[model samples]
Target: MDLKLSERYEDYREAVRVFLEEHRSVWRQPMADSDGRPSAAGRSWQALLIEHGYTCRTIPKQYGGHGGKADILESFIAAEEFHRVGAPTGLANQGISMFVPTLLECGTPEQKERWIRPTISGEIVWCQGYSEPGAGSDLANLQTRAVEDGEDFVVNGQKIWTSSAHFSDMMFVLVRTEPEAPKHHGISYLILSMDTPGIEVRPLKTMTGRAEFNEVFFTDVRLPKTQIVGERGAGWQVANTTLKHERGMLGDPGQANAMLGRVVAIMEEETLDGVRLIEHSGLQDRLLRLQARAQAMKLHGLRLLTHGLKGEDAGVARLIVKLNGTILNHEIAAFAIDVLGELGALYEDSPHLKDRGFWQTTHMFSLGLIIGGGTSQIQKNIISERGLGMPREPKPASKGA
Candidate 1:
């Protein structure tokens, strides 16, 4: 990988930096209410991103995006800018980073024309419906059934941990079309309108005191057969497309780098035993290691993007990045808690709080990253089997078999 920024990219980087600096005040506002859900301001911030055209950075111009190269370096730069200013980019990350890419890769021409443009324009919001009550880490074990009914599929089952489901207008879901087949096969992907009858969204509050996720239940919810993205019974393969999209967004360097800076800033401001937290050698050492890991991960992300631009298979590098991102997030949260001491235990809006109780919030939110998309153990399994070509672990015996 060249690692060198051309003059044009240099200009782009500077422009992003300037924009973030200009918007720092607007972005620094408190995000969640006492309940931990995104405030109305957060939604407004997302609309602001759309208005400013930043939300469509990686989207194709034909699809109403800027259509600049979707390289990791540019994305990193943009993410850093947003993070530095505490921007509301995460609100749109799922829509822009995951769903948009999935649409581009697997959606039919009409699907793209219908959904991509509106999504990029912020006219519609989407949530993922992959994790079921019984099938989170073991995604193939999902039992959500979608029976073919004329020109539509009648979906029935419950999905849990669906982020933004309460606020989203649409959902991308994986459903079992053939239950007798092997667990991984006979699955199909579908897009469903959230307002459809028999669809229920029950938001769940997390340790962070927010309803960022929901338990979505569907009972004979009818969706157009045209909603299927790939061949029926081949949803497993198509689901990989969405997973890859998700991994890329989660492993973005800019987000990690920005987060690291925030963590460091908080540490610097905090003191313990009459000494600044950042001055502690142990903390400094850990922070340094985290910084190095984050930088390496960023470069790895850029390398993957570069290979992608060259039409090369990036393979399991994404898994490595995801693992690293989750680790870094946890480490940063831990460090923040250590620095804040007892104060960290206080939730948002508490008296004498630092950064509106971000430490506590970060600690709570970091665990979600480990469980969302894929678990840390699942990522390890993928890396061992797919990346390192190791033998798969022996399966456990069935309880009653």
Candidate 2:
């Protein structure tokens, strides 16, 4: 692969740098609330980014996006510069990263016009309602029921592990619309206001001490029939589009590189035995290995981008990223803790905590990433059976066959 970028990209990179410099004060200000949800300031900054064609660039302008053509190289440059300056390229949320693309692909024009503007403009937030108490990895097993009754559907069930449910304005959810149909076929995707009567949200605190995830209960919550995205019994198909974007978001190579960079910084600043941790031979070896892996991931991302530009299927390569990227990120965070030794145990509340205990928080969150988009085991099975032509694991005979 050619390591050098062309002159056009070189110029584009400079333009990004100039734009960030010009808007330094606004972008450098705090963008999120204490719980990491986008604040008013952050939303305004995001709108500025959209106006400048810096983010949500591929979506059409009519939908409150920048409306630039898709160009992965420009996207990479923008992300890289944003990371370098510690400015957010865009608000990271299900609304923008996961659901917007899904809506663009599967929503009716009216649906698009109604939600996309407010959602992408940060006027509204949305949470995914796919997982349940019983059905997570096996999502088709979801039992949330939405019975149609006179031009409306009355929904009743509980959804767990829903991120940002408490703060979101609305949700894109899956519910059983036809009980007699096949497990995967009877479901339907629908949008509902979080403030609808009979809806309750109880946040679940994670190890990081943040309540970003929640349990959402719907008790006869009524929704309009028009809220359904695709056909009544075809939610599984619409949901796949959301899941596809979700996996890509979770496995971002840029995020992995940022984690690695932080780890390297920790190594350089930390010390043991009257010497910098970076000077230790054992730590140096580990650092080199991680650096190599980070490079490999970037190169692999370039290959995937090439395939996308050419309209060619990347096959297993795309499937493998979520698994590998999450694992590598977890390892990088763990390595940071290893470098800090006992100090790593200190959290944000502690005065002696290094980097404000960011690594400690990240280390815990990274473990969740391994399980979130799709569990590592599930991803492996997908790669094996679907990508490599391997036979799937046989199902156990039901009771006594």
- The best candidate by lDDT is 2
Q: For model 2, how does the per-residue alpha-carbon lDDT over 162-191 read when each residue is reduced to its tens digit?
A: 998988899999999999999999999999
Q: Please report, in order, the local distance difference test score of every candidate based on alpha carbons.
A: 0.76, 0.86
Q: TM-scores of the models, in the given order?
A: 0.81, 0.93
In candidate 1, clashing pairs total 3
Per-residue lDDT for 167-207 in model 1, tens only?
78889889999988999888997888899999999989987
For residue 251, what is the lDDT in candidate 1?
A: 39
Please tell me which predicted candidate would have the highest TM-score against the true structure.
2
Residue 186 in candidate 2, Cα distance off native in Å:
0.7
Worst 10 residues of 2 by lDDT: 244-253
| Stretches of model 2 off by over 4 angstroms after superposition | 34-37, 243-258, 399-401
